[model samples]
Target: MKTFNAKVNVTLKKSVLDPQGQTVLEALHSLGYKGTENLRVGKYFEVTLNAQDENSAKTQLKEMCEKLLVNTVIEQYEVHLS
Candidate 1:
Protein backbone atom coordinates (compact mmCIF):
# COMPACT_ATOMS: atom_id res chain seq x y z
CA MET A 1 0.00 0.00 0.00
CA LYS A 2 1.10 3.50 -0.76
CA THR A 3 0.66 6.31 1.73
CA PHE A 4 -1.23 9.37 0.61
CA ASN A 5 -1.46 12.79 2.17
CA ALA A 6 -4.69 14.61 1.64
CA LYS A 7 -5.92 18.08 2.30
CA VAL A 8 -9.60 18.71 2.74
CA ASN A 9 -11.29 22.03 2.85
CA VAL A 10 -14.90 22.33 3.92
CA THR A 11 -16.85 25.51 3.42
CA LEU A 12 -20.39 26.76 3.46
CA LYS A 13 -22.21 27.05 0.17
CA LYS A 14 -22.29 30.40 -1.57
CA SER A 15 -25.97 30.87 -0.80
CA VAL A 16 -25.43 30.18 2.88
CA LEU A 17 -24.74 32.91 5.39
CA ASP A 18 -21.43 32.69 7.25
CA PRO A 19 -21.72 34.45 10.56
CA GLN A 20 -18.25 33.51 11.72
CA GLY A 21 -16.70 34.79 8.54
CA GLN A 22 -18.65 37.99 8.80
CA THR A 23 -17.49 38.50 12.35
CA VAL A 24 -13.90 37.96 11.28
CA LEU A 25 -14.32 40.41 8.42
CA GLU A 26 -15.69 42.99 10.78
CA ALA A 27 -12.76 42.45 13.05
CA LEU A 28 -10.38 42.89 10.18
CA HIS A 29 -12.04 46.12 9.19
CA SER A 30 -11.80 47.36 12.74
CA LEU A 31 -8.13 46.48 12.70
CA GLY A 32 -7.65 48.77 9.65
CA TYR A 33 -7.70 46.12 6.98
CA LYS A 34 -9.15 47.96 3.99
CA GLY A 35 -10.41 46.79 0.63
CA THR A 36 -11.24 43.40 2.00
CA GLU A 37 -14.96 43.37 1.49
CA ASN A 38 -15.47 39.68 1.05
CA LEU A 39 -14.43 36.89 3.36
CA ARG A 40 -15.46 33.36 4.23
CA VAL A 41 -14.40 30.90 6.88
CA GLY A 42 -13.99 27.18 6.35
CA LYS A 43 -12.57 24.03 7.90
CA TYR A 44 -9.30 22.45 6.86
CA PHE A 45 -8.16 18.90 7.45
CA GLU A 46 -4.97 17.07 6.69
CA VAL A 47 -5.42 13.34 6.40
CA THR A 48 -3.01 10.48 5.88
CA LEU A 49 -4.27 7.29 4.30
CA ASN A 50 -2.97 4.05 2.89
CA ALA A 51 -4.26 2.99 -0.50
CA GLN A 52 -3.18 0.84 -3.41
CA ASP A 53 -3.13 3.67 -5.94
CA GLU A 54 -3.89 7.35 -6.51
CA ASN A 55 -7.41 6.61 -7.69
CA SER A 56 -8.12 4.55 -4.60
CA ALA A 57 -6.73 7.25 -2.39
CA LYS A 58 -8.93 9.85 -4.05
CA THR A 59 -11.98 7.67 -3.74
CA GLN A 60 -11.40 7.04 -0.05
CA LEU A 61 -10.88 10.72 0.57
CA LYS A 62 -14.12 11.62 -1.15
CA GLU A 63 -15.94 8.98 0.78
CA MET A 64 -14.60 10.35 4.01
CA CYS A 65 -15.72 13.84 3.05
CA GLU A 66 -19.18 12.70 2.02
CA LYS A 67 -19.73 10.50 5.02
CA LEU A 68 -18.60 12.83 7.78
CA LEU A 69 -16.42 15.74 6.83
CA VAL A 70 -18.90 17.68 4.74
CA ASN A 71 -22.49 18.71 5.25
CA THR A 72 -23.73 18.37 1.68
CA VAL A 73 -26.97 20.14 2.41
CA ILE A 74 -25.25 23.37 3.38
CA GLU A 75 -21.56 22.92 2.76
CA GLN A 76 -19.13 21.83 0.05
CA TYR A 77 -15.71 20.22 0.15
CA GLU A 78 -12.59 19.97 -1.97
CA VAL A 79 -9.95 17.31 -1.65
CA HIS A 80 -6.32 17.40 -2.71
CA LEU A 81 -3.91 14.56 -2.41
CA SER A 82 -0.19 14.14 -2.64
Candidate 2:
Protein backbone atom coordinates (compact mmCIF):
# COMPACT_ATOMS: atom_id res chain seq x y z
CA MET A 1 0.00 0.00 0.00
CA LYS A 2 1.07 3.54 -0.59
CA THR A 3 0.35 6.61 1.48
CA PHE A 4 -1.60 9.33 -0.24
CA ASN A 5 -2.54 12.87 0.68
CA ALA A 6 -6.11 13.95 0.18
CA LYS A 7 -7.73 17.35 0.32
CA VAL A 8 -11.47 17.67 0.74
CA ASN A 9 -13.28 20.91 0.17
CA VAL A 10 -16.81 21.25 1.44
CA THR A 11 -18.91 24.20 0.38
CA LEU A 12 -22.50 25.29 0.51
CA LYS A 13 -24.44 24.48 -2.62
CA LYS A 14 -25.19 27.38 -4.94
CA SER A 15 -28.84 27.24 -4.01
CA VAL A 16 -28.10 27.15 -0.30
CA LEU A 17 -27.98 30.22 1.86
CA ASP A 18 -24.81 30.78 3.85
CA PRO A 19 -25.52 33.05 6.79
CA GLN A 20 -21.93 32.95 7.96
CA GLY A 21 -20.68 34.10 4.60
CA GLN A 22 -23.25 36.83 4.49
CA THR A 23 -22.26 37.96 7.93
CA VAL A 24 -18.62 38.09 6.90
CA LEU A 25 -19.45 40.08 3.82
CA GLU A 26 -21.42 42.56 5.86
CA ALA A 27 -18.55 42.83 8.28
CA LEU A 28 -16.15 43.49 5.47
CA HIS A 29 -18.40 46.17 4.06
CA SER A 30 -18.73 47.72 7.48
CA LEU A 31 -14.98 47.76 7.72
CA GLY A 32 -14.83 49.89 4.58
CA TYR A 33 -13.89 47.22 2.06
CA LYS A 34 -15.35 47.97 -1.33
CA GLY A 35 -16.14 45.91 -4.42
CA THR A 36 -16.85 42.80 -2.35
CA GLU A 37 -20.35 41.98 -3.49
CA ASN A 38 -20.64 38.38 -2.41
CA LEU A 39 -18.75 36.03 -0.18
CA ARG A 40 -18.81 32.31 0.49
CA VAL A 41 -17.32 30.21 3.23
CA GLY A 42 -16.19 26.60 3.02
CA LYS A 43 -14.20 23.95 4.84
CA TYR A 44 -11.01 22.19 3.97
CA PHE A 45 -9.93 18.80 5.25
CA GLU A 46 -6.54 17.22 4.76
CA VAL A 47 -6.16 13.51 5.32
CA THR A 48 -3.62 10.79 4.83
CA LEU A 49 -4.80 7.45 3.54
CA ASN A 50 -3.29 4.12 2.60
CA ALA A 51 -4.32 2.64 -0.74
CA GLN A 52 -2.99 0.23 -3.33
CA ASP A 53 -2.98 2.91 -6.03
CA GLU A 54 -4.06 6.43 -6.90
CA ASN A 55 -7.40 5.29 -8.27
CA SER A 56 -8.24 3.44 -5.09
CA ALA A 57 -7.17 6.37 -2.99
CA LYS A 58 -9.43 8.69 -5.00
CA THR A 59 -12.35 6.33 -4.69
CA GLN A 60 -11.91 5.95 -0.95
CA LEU A 61 -11.49 9.66 -0.46
CA LYS A 62 -14.61 10.36 -2.50
CA GLU A 63 -16.54 7.88 -0.43
CA MET A 64 -15.27 9.43 2.75
CA CYS A 65 -16.36 12.86 1.57
CA GLU A 66 -19.80 11.71 0.52
CA LYS A 67 -20.39 9.65 3.64
CA LEU A 68 -18.97 11.86 6.36
CA LEU A 69 -17.17 14.97 5.27
CA VAL A 70 -19.86 16.71 3.25
CA ASN A 71 -23.58 17.22 3.72
CA THR A 72 -25.07 16.38 0.38
CA VAL A 73 -28.41 17.88 1.21
CA ILE A 74 -26.98 21.39 1.31
CA GLU A 75 -23.33 21.08 0.46
CA GLN A 76 -20.99 20.09 -2.35
CA TYR A 77 -17.48 18.71 -2.23
CA GLU A 78 -14.39 18.53 -4.41
CA VAL A 79 -11.62 16.05 -3.78
CA HIS A 80 -7.95 16.38 -4.57
CA LEU A 81 -5.44 13.55 -4.27
CA SER A 82 -1.71 13.92 -4.12
Scored by lDDT, model 1 comes in at 0.95
The global C-alpha lDDT for each of the candidates, from Candidate 1 onward, is 0.95, 0.93
Q: Write the per-residue lDDT of candidate 2 for residues 1-82, one digit (tens) a residue.
A: 9999988889999999999999999999999997899999999999999999999999898888888999899999998888
TM-scores, one per candidate: 0.97, 0.96
List residue ranges in candidate 1 displaced over 4 A.
none
lDDT tens per residue, model 1, 6-55: 99999999999999999999999999998889899999999999999999
Question: What's the lDDT for residue 57 in model 2?
Answer: 95
Q: What ranges in model 2 sit over 4 Å off?
A: none
Best by TM-score: 1
Backbone collisions counted per model: 0, 0
Clashes of 1: 0
